[model samples]
Target: MRASRFFALRERGTDARTEALGGLATFLTMSYIVFVNPAILSSAGLPFDAVAVATALAAGGFTIIMGLTTNLPFALASGLGINAVVAFDIILGRKVSPDVGMACIVLEGLLAVVLVLAGMREAVVRAVPTSLKLAIGVGIGLFIALVGLRDGGIVVNDPSTGIALGDLSTGPALIALAGILVALGCAAANVRGAILIGIATSTVLGLVFGVLDGPSAVARWPTSGDFSTIGDGLAPGALRDALTWALVPIIFSLFMTDFFDTVGTAYAVTSAGGLLDERGEIPKVRNLLLVDSAAAAGGGAMGVSSVTTYVESGAGVAEGARTGLASVVTGLLFALTIFFVPLIAVVGQGVTVGKDTTLHPAIAPALVMVGYLMIQLVREIEWDRPEDAVPAFLTIAGIPLTFSISAGIGLGVFGYVVTMIARGRVREIHPIMWMLVPMFVAFFASNWLSAHVF
Candidate 1:
């Protein structure tokens, strides 16, 4: 068959029907991004509808690219952690415009590709401790949960203490809590599409409680206006602005997150499918990395955030998918969602909770569920060893507390280097890890330097 010949289905031992089923499964598992992404980006002043459009477009287009180029089942989308960095750290915290924030992602993506081509990843990958890499994902998971809580109106800024529990009595908070419970129930039942299911349930409850407005239309054809945010990162001066000295560490942090996440996701997903080669490495992994890296830049260029391969692709692989055909099916599903942006906006649209706080009661459940899922990485760290324990603790705590992924990473690096020296392992530290110490210092003090020196 043409399909079998094109995707090597026969060699991979997966039929076209099986591949289709796998792709459908994958799409169902990770499709929650269509609603959640716009809700997060809109917090940084981007339009909700436009960002929703961009998210679907970038996810669909790049996922297809991944399938075509690498012949892998990995799916791509706006990454959750990287989106937080763009929305909260760079855009809001550093006072840079949204376009400039995305420009940083574009640069990070391009740099990642260059590093891959130059074969310079060995030293950089080996330099960081395994515990730290694991902790970054765990910390970002906590950070995402915190954002979910705030968005759900389950947590609020306290004048006396930094944060306090919100009034669970409110409609939005109650709806969010209900949604979270539903998600947990679904997960416990081993249901596929638990996150998306939770979001749908929450939206229904929000509508019932009058906490969310209904959509004006169910579906509509996308227009040029719907894609207005495309290429915003490449606007004149945006790239140049992202090249400043102050943003050096920020970009580096983004690159690290993008790079490490792909490495981990690729390994785990491929391993699950029994696809690793004799050396215990993924086949054509370089192509996988290349497509993943380009997706990051493509996402930024499309005015979303950095896109990366999703572990959710494992859903497809588990269902007998062994080639890119499954990815093509998943990508097509994502593209079809663009027409339903109006329905999606109903969930993305938030409720006004206070004078200034807008609560996204419908979308909060998915974010909370995703955070819970990511936090599972915490168990992999060897907690008894102080050298690893301290840095991992700092990283896991710093991200949500400081509300800065990069700052949390900086703290972890500092703790790692300090602990290594104190443990008499000074000479064992990789030169690259040592180099990161001063860079993180500059990152931590960039604001001060900008005000006084630079």
Candidate 2:
């Protein structure tokens, strides 16, 4: 089959332009990782440029693999939470070396690949309630919006008020507001590439208004030798020292977090893309899972943290991404960052705003709009049933509040099990639920586990 026929672009009513635009939307929303991953990892003695280069390759390469093999419009990259855990809790806090952290990532990733090849993921998907699955999708949408608002200076953290409206009087805030209006209007008009066009408009407006300055270099190559320090560069016996019984909980926690986090993201984004089967389960799931494991292993080899799926891919799905072509477009865009650093910086980089002049601009509108689109999934929940409504609400409400996808999933599972058993529906629980509930309990008690076991 020709690649286009295999992707069913004509059958699904999507053309190359739509797929390209969807991919661009997904890339723009998630590209912040290129800047963020390096900044967080460099604190633990890694080189900034080296981490930056690795981040781009990890995201682009593995995401392209996802696009080609599974044809789902999902992207994978070094995860946000796991990076901090590796940097702060493992390396810096425990006095473990960075090289050992990479080793741990490789081991953890190997476990994930093993699970996939062994065909053990089916029950894990079946364990999640349908209402909660939709909630997961909706929750990720809201989470992406919240992140964009905070990043764009449209919403600021207020110690007294929790989250207050940012000073819209500033330039970046104004740009965000303008971008939101323009993007919304374009979407309403059923325009192609509305999200990408909105972002481009905002960047051009920023430059014209002196809000965002251009980068010094137009097109520069990465000048770092970071790839030289990958999985094999352990600190003599550091890998062994880091792998004692005490490290079990820590590694387990990493595995649990990486495992479920990817599950939630993959479920949420694919659902938004209308890729779920009749039972709300992903088709060819085992094959899809391989890309995630490959991404994590590749990230480890590149000296980064555990790689996982980004919920921001929901932004593209909301904009009408229905196939892997979107993922290919997204990956190619990320790869271009290596040479087009300056161009990406102008849009993806933060624009100075607010009193301290520290906020990113130009991308918040697309996020908020996509979030609005995801909210419709809430209606799909079987709200008439208390068992469904309660857990679904917990998941939808808790995701943005907790700032963690896995946290919301845990709470929803807890709510569902409690409600089901309380309602005398104990027999309704899947066997996998018993396994998941205890794992969730362990995840919630992770800090205590660390203090006692580790």
TM-score, every prediction: 0.92, 0.77
Clashes of each: 0, 0
For candidate 1, report its TM-score: 0.92
CA lDDT, every model vs. true structure:
0.86, 0.75
- Candidate 1 residue-wise lDDT, 123-191, digit = tens: 465467878877877887788788888889899999999899999999999988898899989988988
Highest TM-score scorer:
1
Candidate 2 lDDT by residue in tens digits, 1-454? 4867978888777877888888988897777677556655766777665667678887998888898898888887788667766876778877877878776777777778887787765566666676776787677678767866775778888999899998888788788778877877987896655666667777788888998887677777766464555554244465576577666656666676677667766776777677888876787688787878767766877887887888778778877888889999899888877665556556655554436545557766656665666676777788999999988889888878976666777888889999999999999998887787888787778778777875
Candidate 2 global CA lDDT score: 0.75
Stretch of 10 with least lDDT, candidate 2: 226-235
Task: Please list the residue runs of candidate 1 whose C-alpha ends up more than 4 Å from where it truly belongs after superposition.
Answer: 10-13, 384-388, 422-427
**Which candidate wins on lDDT?**
1
